[model samples]
Target chain A: MNLQARRTGFAVAGIAIICTAYSARLVDLHVVKHEEYARLAAEKHSFRQPIQAKRGMILDRNGEILATNLPVRTIVADASHIQNPDELASLVAARLELEKEAVLEKISTGKKYIVLKRMVPDEVAVALQNELQARKLRGIYLENDSIRTYPNGAMLGHILGYLNHERNGVQGVECTMNKELAGVDGHRFIERDRTGKEIMLYRGAEAPAEHGKNVRLTIDMGLQSILESEVDAAFDKLKPETMNAVMVDPSTGEILAMVSRPAFDPNRPGDFQPSQMKNRAIIDMVEPGSTFKIVVAAGALNEGTVTPQSSIFCENGRFSYGGRTLKDHHGYGHMDVHEILVKSSNIGSAKMALMMGGEKFHEYVRRFGFGERLGIELPGEIRGLVHPPNRWDKLTITRMPMGHSIAVTPLQITMGMSVIANGGRLMAPTVVKTIEEPDGTVFRANPPRVIRDVVPKETASFIGNALVGVTQPGGTATQARVNGFEVAGKTGTAQKVSEKGGYAPGKYVVSFVGYMPAENPRFTLLVMIDDAKVDSSVNYGGIQAAPIFSRVAERAARHLDLIPTAPSVPLQTAPVVSATTPNRRL
Target chain B: MNLSFLTIRSANRIRLRPILITVAVLSVILCTALGFVSIKLSQHAVAEEIRKTERAVTRLRSENEVLLAAVTRLSSRQHLTSLVAQSKIAANYITADRVARLTPPASDEGDSATRTALNTVPSRSATR
Candidate 1:
């Protein structure tokens, strides 16, 4: 071959080899490692941005907001992107009410993600963002966040619980209805620019958040305020270990007002002890004292063991049974069922319970919603301690009739009186009224529920009339009478049950459970004072708790706009004293 | 006889038609590419505008919520109660007798001074 032709052939072969090598490399990249490289590129540019759902608000029956969300921001910094750390830190510290040195220490770490401060107010965060933008600063961002706030502070704290750091409810209605209050969060696939700003053009698939539903409670803030003020005054004056008050609509079993002393502010739950967070109305168990007498009295009448006119002879204040002597506050002769209840005769109640068998009396007790949880919507409700007939000893029948052997919650005592006020039906107590969507559309409503009838209507009316005599001039609880209204109630002065054994000396749990306008009952109220540090003589339920009941009932009546059905009585003037200082009176 | 003359004429002629067609096709391709780029840039600008609008709306909504929460806090029953106790406002509960009810009591036989309504029955003059 010629020399020129040989050189041309060699150049053509070199070009062919280069083309073949390029084809093989293209195949490897397009087929073999395509998925791997694509995934790496996506990870570098795209991320899943979470969209937070707002927590629901708690509202009173009249549409007053109780618990609500205060919109906040979580200030974050990208330390790696921060150019002027000192200026950025100073601005953030001033806007967030934080220390500049601490913020500087955080930004100096050179980390990509740093939380400068959480729960910064929305206004403050906006101001900081504007400042940063005007100065052309980068790296600082505001994350959407919120905090649960109870505007009423410690008022109704026990019923409207608080949330934890993870934004989960820790107690009260918040805990019980958490599923309804916490809506499902959503997310979207998003791409960001080199500056971490979302590239809205490259946004991918997204699902919008489903916000939580609002919860409306049955509580009336008017009635609640009245109850709380009265209870607060009593707690201050009496200086009891604990005090509880609950008001309910007798016909519907709707809880109108409930207050427990030693309450913690839900907004600052961390600052209080666990004891103060207890909802004592449903959680704390105490002897129902003479309030339990209505059970045996009603049972005797219903079971035909004793007529309303049936007379039982009292042993003149003291009676011996099962090797124990039971004494009344005063000596009494023969008294009928009405007189026995009006005078709060322990011996008379025991006699009536004896007339009815133990099993029958126990049945009546359970029928009155005792020994069982009333199924309130609040969390941590207890059934309270009540032994069956088989568990009772010789003295159990006698003592249980007068509320000595068994324990019951203050709520149970109020509901037991409701049986009379509601004409024998024991209605299930409820706090939540309705669950509503964000747009004020009701999603679910809780209607009043009737559990069962404890007695006939005639028997309930008879018992109710007898209870009215309890607040009359000659009765034991005259102080419980409301002006221009007939108050039917019972006074219970129970000796506190000691941890060691029997009753504690000179320490009492005094309570008055009643309903006003006895003929057509409006509400059933209970005022309970535990371990009131007063003289034993002045610590009786009729003397101490009944007066509180009277004040609360009067105010509640006025709030309800109920006109006077009877003549007003003369107001009594009594000395107010702090029970802690027994010798000082106001 | 004239075949050689025809062949020489064809070979010497300039190919103006093919050159003109190729130039036209190249120009069309370049203009289409430029148009696609312009459309993409416009879409980016619109998306950026949309993103700014969304951010503004979110900020405004957040501000509204903050103000609402403040209003709720200030108007809460607890706050009002404290204000009343401090005597910041002169508020009082009207006595029952002073509250003139639209409907008279079912029975108005009690103390006339403490009656809920000023008149037990509707006046004929007012009704007329």
Candidate 2:
């Protein structure tokens, strides 16, 4: 071949080799490395974001909001994007109520993510965002957040518990009904461009969050405030170590108002101790004192062991049984059942218990819902101690009848009286009224639950009439009387149990449990003052607790608008004993 | 004769090339303009709708928050009690004497005032 022909052939061969190599590289990129490249692209643009659900609100029976959420923003920073760390830090510090130096230190680190402040309210966050935009600043980002707020502060702290950092209920009804209150959270797949702006066109795969359900409690804030005010006054005036009160509607077993002193605010529970956070109405166990006498009286009436007119001979204020001397406040002769209760004759009650055997008395005690948990909706209830018949010593029968050698919660004592006030039925106490949906639909409603009938109507009325005498002129709790209403109640003065296992000297747990307008009872209220700082002689329930009961009952009657069933008489005050004088029982 | 016809056909084909190229250029220009306008119009419509939705959401949220704040302030027991303490609100308690009986008397035996007080019935609305 000639020289020109050979050169042409070489050029064609070089072109063919280049074409083959390009085809091979295209095949590898399109087939072998496709998945890895696709994943990297997605990571650069798209992210999975969690849509947070709003927690439920807690409301009172009157539709007053108790616990609610305040919308807030969590300010986050991208340190790497910050151009002027000092300026950003100062602006954030002023707007978010944070330390400037700390914010500066955090932003100076070339990290991508830093949290500047959490729970900045909506207004503050809006102001900060506007300032950043106008000044052409960068690095700060706002994410949605919320804070749990109790509008009434410490008013219902024990019942409507507070939440923790993760928005989980930590105590009280909040913890018990957490699942119903906390709604389901949703998720979404979203894409953002290089400018960190959401690309609406590329948004995909979203599920909207279901907001939490609202909880409406049976608590009436009006009644609650009344109870709290009275209890506060008592706590201040009597100077008790700890005081608690519970008020329940006997007809329905609905807890209207319950309060305990030294309460911690649920909004800021971190500052309080566990002891102060306890719902003492259901948790604290105390010897019911003379309030337990109603149980024996009801049992004797229901069991046909005693008639309302039957007279029992008293031991003249002192009776020796099982090496222990049982004594009444005063000497008495033969008195009927009503007279025995009016004067709180301890020997008479012990005799009635003796008439009914220990086993029968224990049965009556159980039937009144004592020595067992009342099963209220609030968490951490305790079944108080009631010794079984087999466990009772010879002295147990007498002591138990007089509210000794037994333990019961304040809720139990109030409910035991309810059996008498409601005309012969035991009711299961309830705090929750209804569960509501976000759209104001009631998801579930609680109705009155009747546990069982403990006695006949006639029997309850007979005992109720006797309890009415308790607040009369010659009775023990005369201070419990309201001007236009017939108050039926019992006064208990229990010697405080010592830490070493015997009765404490000069210390008493005094209480008055009662109902007003005795013909048609409205509420059964229990006011318990533990360890009042007074002379033991004047530290009786009739003196300290009954007066408070009267004050609260008077206000409650007006609030409830219950018509006067009895004629209005001249208001009379209980005989005042000077604080300096040695105390004496009625 | 065949050679002459071949020369004439070749000359006609060369003359028609510029006309065909002009038509093709015009078509390309028209198509590009129409597509650009359509896409711009669509993007503007979508952005406007998005802005409208955002404003609605913001307004509803603001109203809801305002109502909630008002309810919270008014219904709060602490606030109302404070009002009562300051005498800004009336917590009136009607005495038995103020209440007049609507029903006929049950008995005329006791003191007339006492009988009237016992017969008066409270309105249920007042209680709630």
Candidate 3:
């Protein structure tokens, strides 16, 4: 059996030798060919993406594009891959109107990918592509990208704001609501060539970008245009240090227009100071002048301390009260309540305040929402100085009544006037109307947040009628009278306080606050000409501010389409001759 | 013992069975390796198919961009206004509003950059 054992050993060795060779081949595939196997495995997990979603738009109330993302093209070139570099450069230079040398310089390199152009229009990109393809040129490429575009230009610039070069919102609503305005970026999952070109891999997988939400502002574009144009004129003609205008729906407090002069184009917001970039309607605070008189008048009428027919006795041209001389525009012998506003009698106004008493007068100013923020949804606001009754100075009680010893912002004064105009309910001013989601979801700010009923509707109406006399034939602001509408207005000439110390010597704050269709007001406009033209003859708020108020009021009243109530009222007084109230040697 | 033919034949047959079994095992090990190689080659071909499709998609995209640009240029307001004057399609000089995408109409928000249909396109916006 030794012969049989030897044969068995030989057969077993032969089988072992064959199995070793086969196992070596398998090891070569798993280890020696590891790179190839890994590559093959990766092929299962590749993807490509196309057509990134467009960023959402900013539309006006009527679907006009206040802001939009226009489709732009980025031209790129694979310099190494190019077949005829000169031909591609020539086409790009010709179509893009670029310097031939510049185009040549870009394609001269051996780099596979080079930026030929950026922010190109889709049309230009397609043209370049077509030109290249027709010639079978290989290197040139085009990528579709988007750039933020503002269609209205500088119409509502600061309020609308703009995106920077990196597509970042930097100011205005665009900055404040940037999270909603900017879209989430997404990428194509395609296999890239060594030079970063998307390879000829199969369409594998994709995660599309989530587009941003569209924002529609409360501003009416037409009204915005009107306010912009008017404000521009005021700055040019009047040439004030600064001018601001805000028009809001008194009933709802929805801001129809909020315009500040010295506006910069949002397309290049970086070129200006932060002050020029602010929406002054919400941010800036100025001495309210005589406009604050509405709050005091409305309160006194509401408290039953004064009636529509309540009269005041003026102490000739100047009356000494509270260790101060209360002056009048002229030496009025005896003026009635309505005539007091017509004459802008400081003495009569102080006397009326005295009748209301210091405590009640202070309560009226606070209740009218003065001496505090108007509660508008914006970044910066100022709480104007009213010296809460407990902090009144020796002369504060009397002087505050004549529109002094107090400071107020344009926004605060506007809200206070709105209370009287909107039948005694003080509405909170609002700039933003609504916010929308990408999935067509909408959230609105539509709350009628009343601060307080500072005055009765009847009293407010009575005060409004008295205001009309100020724009009558022989009134303080006669120039503010509209041809069709009986204007209710007040003229104010207050000495501007210096920034360093006390009141400036020569500079004056000449202004007028008025509402059109006097009997039933629809719009309240406040026009102030700070440090206005003060010549020897014509130096009063009636001359400088009243005319601007009238121009703006006439245009606004006609545009608003409000019919005049008393168009044929009989003329009871002479034509306005003098607004000379500053003759008092202070 | 004399030469016994039955015992010798039994021993040879046992040795022959082991030798045949060894050959059969060797043949299967080599054949299975060859089969694995063939399947791997097929997988490589399927992967190449994806690569080829991606190249085709790239070419198509480039072509789409070319066509879109051609359409924009051919219908551009500047091109059409030049066409109208040079071609003399209309009898008299055209108003700016008659041009394509160049001017806004008499009414509505007729800005220069507003979107325009063929009807809204001004045939002549050139002040020349």
Candidate that scores best on TM-score: 1
Q: In model 3, what lDDT does residue A470 have?
A: 78
* TM-scores of chain A in all candidate models: 0.92, 0.90, 0.79
**Model 2 regions more than 4 Å off:** A1-44, A84-86, A575-586, B1-52, B55-63, B83-128
Q: Could you tell which candidate, 2 or 3, scores higher by DockQ?
A: 2
lDDT tens digits, residue span A174-246, model 1: 9998999999998888997877788887898899988999999999999999999998888878888899999
* All candidates: interface RMSD: 0.8, 2.5, 7.5
Q: What TM-score would every model get versus the actual structure?
A: 0.89, 0.84, 0.69
Name the runs in model 1 displaced over 4 angstroms. A1-41, A97-99, A574-577, A580-586, B1-32, B104-128
Q: Which of 2 and 3 is ahead in lDDT?
A: 2
Pairs of residues at least 3 apart in sequence or in different chains that clash in candidate 2: A537-A583, A538-A583
Candidate 3 Cα misplacement greater than 4 A, ranges:
A1-55, A77-114, A186-188, A193-205, A270-278, A307-310, A332-337, A354-360, A377-379, A436-449, A534-539, A568-586, B1-128
Give the fraction of native contacts in model 2. 0.21
Interface RMSD (Å) of candidate 1: 0.8
lDDT assessment of candidate 1 = 0.90
Candidate numbers sorted by TM-score from highest down: 1, 2, 3
The predicted structure with the larger TM-score, 1 or 3, is 1
lDDT (Cα, tens digit) per residue for candidate 3, span A1-586: 8999999998999988888888898899888998898667766555345556556666665555677655678888877777676777788899888888898988887886688778887667777778877877777767778766565556688778777777777767777667767767666556655444455433345666777777767677666666667667656655555667776667777677777766777756767776677766666655666666666667666777777777667888788866777777688767766777677777777777888888889888888887788766555667877787778776776678778888877777777777767788888877667667655577443455777776778887877777887788777777777766788777777788889978888777767777666666676666665554445245467877677676676567656655555655443332323322332210
TM-score of chain A of 3: 0.79
Residue A217 C-alpha lDDT in model 3: 71
